[model samples]
Target: MVQSIVEELEPLFNPKSVAVVGATTNWNKWGYSTFTSALNGFRGPVYPINNKESEILGHKAFARVTDIPDAVDLAIIVIPSTGVAAVMEDCVAKGVKAAVIISAGFAEIGKEGKRLQDEVLSIARKGNIRFIGPNCMGFWSASSDLRGFMFPLPVKDGPLAFVSQGGNVGGAVVTSGFMRGVGFHRYVSCGCAADIQIEDYIEYFGEDPEVKVILAYIEGLVDGRRFLDKVKKVTPTKPVIVLKPGKTDAAAKAITSHSGALAGSDEAYEAAFKSIGVTRVESPEELLDVAIGFLTQPLPEGRNVAILTPGGSYGILCAEACATEGLEVVKLPDRVIAALDKVFPPRWSHGNPIDPAGDRNLLTYLTAPGKLLKVDEIDSLIFMGFSGFSIYTSLFVSRESGEGAPWISSREAFREVAKEFTRAVSLKDTVKIGQTILPIVSGMASRMGIYHEEDVSELTEIIAAAIVSGRLRVPFLVSAFLPPGSEALAEMGVKTPPTANEASAHFLVAMAEQWVASYKKPVLTTTFFTVDQPRLEGTHYAYPSGRHAARVLIKMVEYKEYLDVSQK
Candidate 1:
């Protein structure tokens, strides 16, 4: 009821019982989708409210909210605009705790609509009832088994919390996120946000333990200062990534009409977001890419970077990205050079990049980046060509084909090949270079370890074990590594990408930024940034371009350093 911050929104998110006020079975209407959405995976009871119908969606229908025999924790209103106020009266009488009004024709339409929205809001406050929208898609949470969106969200679960003012944009976010395997902990399309504003959700999710990162897609905010204040308190503890797209005058006007919100001075929002350490993204893709990077990778320790690329031009492009992000491309220290010298091919670009002489398979590609992580001189790393090796690995797998060898006989073996490669390519996932992944890495600890073989996340490590234990596959890897990757892979096999993936290498830079952030240092760092395949091992928020992503990372790192110094 107009609380400064709506504390414990669990009832709204994880309700014991839910009622669809405008419940209907009309296949084409919003009411149908909204009502049925709850039943898909919601853990509790659902009641459908319809004045005339005896039954809706197979649930015993009620003529009014007051008619329900038990208390209702949440109500979803999708009735026609003219009748919503009466329904609210019923909801208040029935002692509803929260409501999500999916009705339109509100303030954005004209004066009359604003009056109707205001009347309903006043009643809601008087009853001490909190609500989400007068014009919105509602909410969805995987952990609570709730679905209150425009439609059923994919049953995916992860650590990002997304809040959006635009229902369409938020819908796309959840849909795209599901396809990309980027799971969401919560999604609130804070439509109209008549009773509960953006600030409330910002601070709520900022502290929500289930959320590692917060992604907000705002066309506009109802109260900018409230949001800024809440964000300042929250951003320091959890990363807040926002996509505020109402920069142009035309778009600003649309934002106002869409959510009845003033897309206030774009400059002010920009400055506020930056000042509070919020990661401001410009597109949906960036929102998802950065989210995934933050979720999957470990943070870097400082601004010092180690870049490994397969091509010279790609390496140069990455260097430009580094400069754009204010990341220093530190030269290879002597120890790093010596460590890499032992493994690099003839005429390799033997410095910071550790570029192979040419294109290579997963093992060789990973070996250089893996070696670079050992140097204390560098604090972060980026890999650009590792995905190409996914294609290269198949060549070795098919050398024996479906009819030939033992390891190549089953589909599981084929997939195992990729998993083996992923383990090495994803060295960042296996362990924190400076942090302990297991109890100990020393020789003494290895002997004491009960599950030493399972400790490693690499196939190369597994193969090494196989060799040591005398159960080896001789021709596949031995002769496979003798020739250089390009000739060896091509001489053996290197198929063109099944068809190109339009995704660029830019998200890798974003992942790098998020990766280094795991250390909570006042600098940006990453261990993998090499280009290719739309996937980031498994999930990422979006990838704008190396240059754009680097610029965003630069902003975050700068703010971090500023915060650290100011506090000191």
Candidate 2:
């Protein structure tokens, strides 16, 4: 039964033809925004209905829904709340099956408004029509190019699915998501849920093949038991993330008045969420963080983490967060420490966090990552670094350096000397010795994309490590530390500028940890502090130099998740 409903809802987004019952020419009105968004986003035929206007946005406007010349699969109602019933009736007369009501001032207003909402539902029921909302923002379906709301923003098509109780909230989620690399398959804004409730959308997305992560910005749940049942069926197959507002009594009262909702007890909702395996996040940012993590990384088998940082402070913070989140920060075995000692200087911290203190040059930056990744005690690694020397070094060596140079030769010499020393020592477990050095060597070779004398040696070490680590199965999260008053850092380069709050190094770490907890995957983030001037329009926003580390981390995790899941 649930599967059939999911299948049925697919067409609501992928309709062949749509009718805009209250379409208008004024750009400020909801009718105009809905019509324009549909024309811009939907690939299907659109009919605009406006009694007073002959045409809107160059499309011929009909006087009523029944006057449309072609068959209409979807009807968008942008009229006043009091007029929704009549518009819905006209839709039924025109043989429209689905309706999206983008009007406000319905049940959310008061009892008088509730009476009008009840009438609208009655009319839709009598006509056997399924409607989305009476006080909502509408929805968007990337697959179908169906955007039925007033948000005049652009979005990409991907696996994330979002559902929100407020139209503005949905718009914010979509906007923020697009700014990041994450995209969406569908978005739903079911205000008041008078006709179709939140559970309906959850059930629909739960069975959707295109949607891997389901996110909800929820204020209240109408039917707790049914919602939990749906979540139980969905979560094992896909991740369900919820960002519920109304935590305080004041907030709950505000929510109830705003949406005409019965904001339930905050504790009760929290308990229900935990009982159903639904991951609860605190803010909109956390919701997106977890959604991105689930969409990008594989779930770790256990809560044991291997922390890696370019500095000691970040390592300590990572350790604290891991413990607080009920995850064990395992100690690196002596053998692993001994192997690290071969590459790092005497002052390096060879403990679990693996902090190579002092200025980390490009060579150390690149080499340390692979070493931490190869360790057996560490199931996963989190790389934390700051701007200035470390970010420049890592990016330069890993991305910009066209030819393998000084460090490449040094790595080869070290490997050959280590191999001879192991043989001289008659170490039976030279397998571990070879395993530790190989990945570092090969990673450098791969980065250079050429086979030189150094390349052969480095590749050899990496291959040996791969064999020992069972193909080096490790998930890594990267973070970049930023200095205080770092708002100027956002304008340093030709990319998306980071917000002041987003540029904070501590916020980045918190965001990554929240991602791990919410989605059970490793996350990477970076920060920067700069004094560069802001770019004007037509010029791209300048993202700080260190921010690229976070971007790379996000991309790597996403690719890994795609390969793992797709192979399965």
Highest TM-score among the candidates is held by which one? 1
TM-score of each: 0.76, 0.74
Q: Whose lDDT is greatest here?
A: 1
The residue-by-residue lDDT of candidate 1 on 432-500, one tens digit each, is: 321221222222123322222322233234333333322332223323222223232333244321111
Q: What is the lDDT of residue 133 in candidate 2?
A: 80
In order, the Cα lDDT scores of the candidates are 0.65, 0.64
The residue ranges of model 1 lying beyond 4 angstroms of the native Cα positions read 1-8, 359-361, 394-556
lDDT of 2 by residue, 1-568 (tens): 3437665575577788888878888877888888888888677899999999998888889999888888999998888877788888888787888888888888788999999989888888877677888788888888788888865766778788988997787888888777765678999888888876787788888878899889898888778888887777776577778888887889888887878888898889988876666777776756775676565455554445666566777678667766655566788777768766755668888787777676454344444444444544554555554323334434323222233323335445545644553452245343565554455554544554433444245434443443333222111101121222222223222134332222332222333333334344453433333343122111112223222323323333333444455447
Clash number by candidate, in order: 19, 9
lDDT of 2 at 432: 61
- The alpha-carbon deviation from the true structure for residue 508 of candidate 2, after best TM-score superposition, in angstroms, is 18
User: All candidates: CA RMSD in angstroms?
Assistant: 9.4, 11.2
True lDDT of residue 365, candidate 2: 47
